[model samples]
Target: MEIEMIIACDDGEVKKLGYGKTVISCLSYREVWPEKIKIGIVHTDGLDATSILSYLIKVLGNNKKSLVMFDSITIAGFNVISLPGIEKLTGFPSIVIYNYKPSIKNLLNALRPHFIDSKIRELAINQIKSYEKIESKKGILYIVNRGVNKEDAIEIINSYQFYSRIPEPLRLSHIITSQISKIINPYAN
Candidate 1:
């Protein structure tokens, strides 16, 4: 059977030094382990959707049969990605997987006080509202998908998950970003 290319992306914490850019890491895998890895930096609360799309395009190159996954839609503080934008730009399906069900009220409360950008808040709200809850062997997972049906997304997610509810590519990308964050900002608590 031909293995599907799963490209999982996650972002590190905002760096304490410099302009507080966050490291975005993508791990591409066909099976249990990653075949390729790519990393990029984006300014905290900046236009991360554009940056992420560019980074994904660079990583994807000519590979069109890939499925993109994100740990969450909101990355590097309030920098949120547009799911439909990613799907259209890459010509591939994209899914955002969450271990726990997301709270829209909490998100709204967080976004209302600090950000004046209504566009950002709107995008975030729209993305979170699209999530569908799926019950798996591991546990319940909340996911938002574009260009892929919920059944196929759940199948893909289930096949990749071995030790945890989170898929391998996402798990690895998260670990990689977290470690890179510490290395980049040694003094960050």
Candidate 2:
């Protein structure tokens, strides 16, 4: 059984930290849908990948590895984190989906002031492997994938997306994170 952990982040009054929600689902060919299994929350400061890793470990408990999916590579933390960092640390192949291709130039421009070497960051960006773009009757999406084959990625997206252009897990995660952040931070609207 293949399991996917879909992630989405919601920001609150806390400017530095973001509330990230992960929706875990078991994928099966028979159902052609993601079976909801678990949901987890991670509190992260901008640019802190360690917090994310720790929260995931706490949530996952026994399951050390699963296919990790994120609405974007940089969440919770402005563009302060790296996709390779998450994939390498967790040992889970990560798949990042977007409505448009990520902007390398803009990202580097944003990071230049903070980091000593923009070139190294550029190299990391270049190494990201993009599989075929997913174009369905519902919508068009760009994907950056690591550790999973192209066929499986396509299948995962197809199985999870039912009601909208966004995959069900992503949509669910978004809703969960939004509601959770509001409760966690009463000041946030």
Candidate 3:
């Protein structure tokens, strides 16, 4: 069976600069460690869905068959990206994987205070509501997907798990983002 290309995204710790921001890293893979890596910055607790999507589009230019994976929908401190929006824009299946099920109530509580606009908060809540729980060899994973069935998503995820529950592309992206963030913001914890 031929392995489809996988592009996975993950963010590092937020740096406490003006309004707070973090490094977003994405790595592409196909039965290998990584074929390409891209990085971007996004504001913490900001409405950065468009920014995240734009970054992914750039990374996945002309690559229609690749699967896009996210460590979480909410990255860079509540900067939520829409899986459906990504799928529509990039013409690729998208998935958000979580080691544990996300708490909608807690997410709502956190967003309510930060985002005054009801539409923005509602969008985030709706995205969280779409997650479906699935069991893998590693453990349970909560996921939300677009342009792909749950079984295919699970199979793709399982194929990428070698070191941990997190997919290899996402795991590598996380490590790259963390090290880059430390270099960029030495004082950030």
Candidate 4:
């Protein structure tokens, strides 16, 4: 069997940048270590999809099958990324995982202040509502996926949640980005 590659994208915030630094990780899913980790900066709680995606594509190259996982569709704040666009662009199976049951309307109200652009706000709202539910040890996980069906995505999620309720790629991403953010800016939240 071929080893599956996972490109897990996460962002870290610094007070200096309006957004933060996005860490795009090239990881072997089962092995649980990052093969390539690249950092790309984004506006503090702002638009990062384009820059982060473009950078990862260049680093990862073409015609390679991989899985893309996001800690959330809206990173930072209302800064949203598209799973379908990424799946189409990179030909990778993509999954968006959220541990809590998300309320899009409530999120929209909270995030409305951050986004001046209506389009960005709308996209963020849409992304927030795009997930289907997957029950896990922690709680209900809301997920949206492309290049993989609902049944397969569930199986994939279950298979990955070995050590904990948190998936390996996402758990590793949280660890790495948090550390990187602190190192990048100790004073930052």
Candidate 5:
């Protein structure tokens, strides 16, 4: 199955970018390994759903019988990406919003004595949690074909938690992304 994911780097901070990279790596790993799936990625600076959705339609080139796997849907992000008449065109796009926050206090307690680190962790957790719960308030609607459903989508996303915070697919994608960057920046001696 073809899996397309729209990823947004909400905050332009380095930490947020790093997390975005990890997410890409995990996506790549999942795409390359296993039965070998087709993965598409769209990255945006601001969470503009309309723009994102427009871009997706442009990239997809007529979305008929296509399966989309969304990592999240922030209103802003959703606004940027929601396409007009997209549901009618695209078939069964299963959305997989990774929901599950471990809590800020818990994270700080586990890390210990690192205020900066703690705060960064908190922000990341909050962003992800918000995407899963708050951002999805509008809810996602897709026409399902065979082998597609909300439960299936959730299961696929849940499978990634077994390994690390970043899913295997995105983790691997991040590695590839970094490698490409390194090709230009190279390494410091």
Candidate 6:
């Protein structure tokens, strides 16, 4: 069976870590959607969470079977803290990208919040669970690396739904977005 997954990624570099989304998208391309898949992007002039969510829902349609990924890029903290409403909006299985350097297990150990990442993960899982509001299924959230190489790619994939890692639809989206970004922002690195 083909698995459908949605990933919300970080969209800025540094704090605007949108590249995190690209990394997830790239992995999706190489590992998941090897051929054809529908992909879309949603961004905003400001961090208007409600607007972003609205735009995504409108474009993706209300089919729960469709995976809706968020490019958590640098904006996840904002969502976790303020956009509780968005959690309710995502009626499909959703994944957000977190691009920290350490493994979630390691971060849980060294971080001052003790199990902060774990807590957030649990929170996401639970919130999505509540949002799904259906039996026999629930939305999922994943934390993965911005891998540097093919081996790292494997490690990153081990963290998510697939056996080898990375889903195909998102990977294609990354390549398409990168090329488009260059054309759209020629000077951007």
Higher-scoring candidate on TM-score, 1 or 5: 1
Candidate 5 at residue 11, lDDT? 13
Candidate 5: minimum summed lDDT over ten consecutive residues — where? 7-16
Q: Residue 81 of model 2: what lDDT?
A: 38
| Global lDDT of model 3 | 0.75
lDDT of each: 0.78, 0.53, 0.75, 0.65, 0.34, 0.35
lDDT string for model 3 (1-189, tens) is 233688888877775644486777777776676877777778776677556755665565455468888877787877778776676667677788888888888777777776767467468557878889998778788988877888888888888888888878888888888888878775544
Regions of candidate 4 where Cα sits further than 4 Å from its true position: 1-3, 13-33, 136-139, 186-189
lDDT of 5 by residue, 40-63 (tens): 233322333334343443344343
Stretches of candidate 3 exceeding 4 Å from the true structure: 1-3, 186-189
The parts of candidate 2 lying over 4 Å away from their true place are: 4-14, 17-45, 54-58, 79-81, 114-132, 187-189
Instruction: List model 4 lDDT by residue over 1-189, tens digit each.
Output: 232666677766434542354433333343555666666556655666655665575466444556777877776555677766676667677778878777887777777776678566577458666678887655578888867777777767776776776687778777777677667664333
Q: After superposition, how far is residue 188 of candidate 5 from its true place, in Å?
A: 18
Ten-residue stretch with the least lDDT total in model 4: 18-27
Off by over 4 Å in 1: 1-3, 186-189
Please provide, for model 6 over 1-189, each residue's C-alpha lDDT reduced to its tens digit, 9 standing for 90 to 100.
Answer: 133433333332212235322111222222344433333333322234444554454344344333334443223232331234444565433343322222434423443363434454444333322221111111232432221232333333343434222333343444565554444343322
- Which residue pairs come into collision in candidate 2? none
Ranking by TM-score: 1, 3, 4, 2, 6, 5
TM-score (C-alpha, index-matched) for candidate 2: 0.66
The numbered model that scores best in lDDT is: 1
- Overall local distance difference test of candidate 6: 0.35
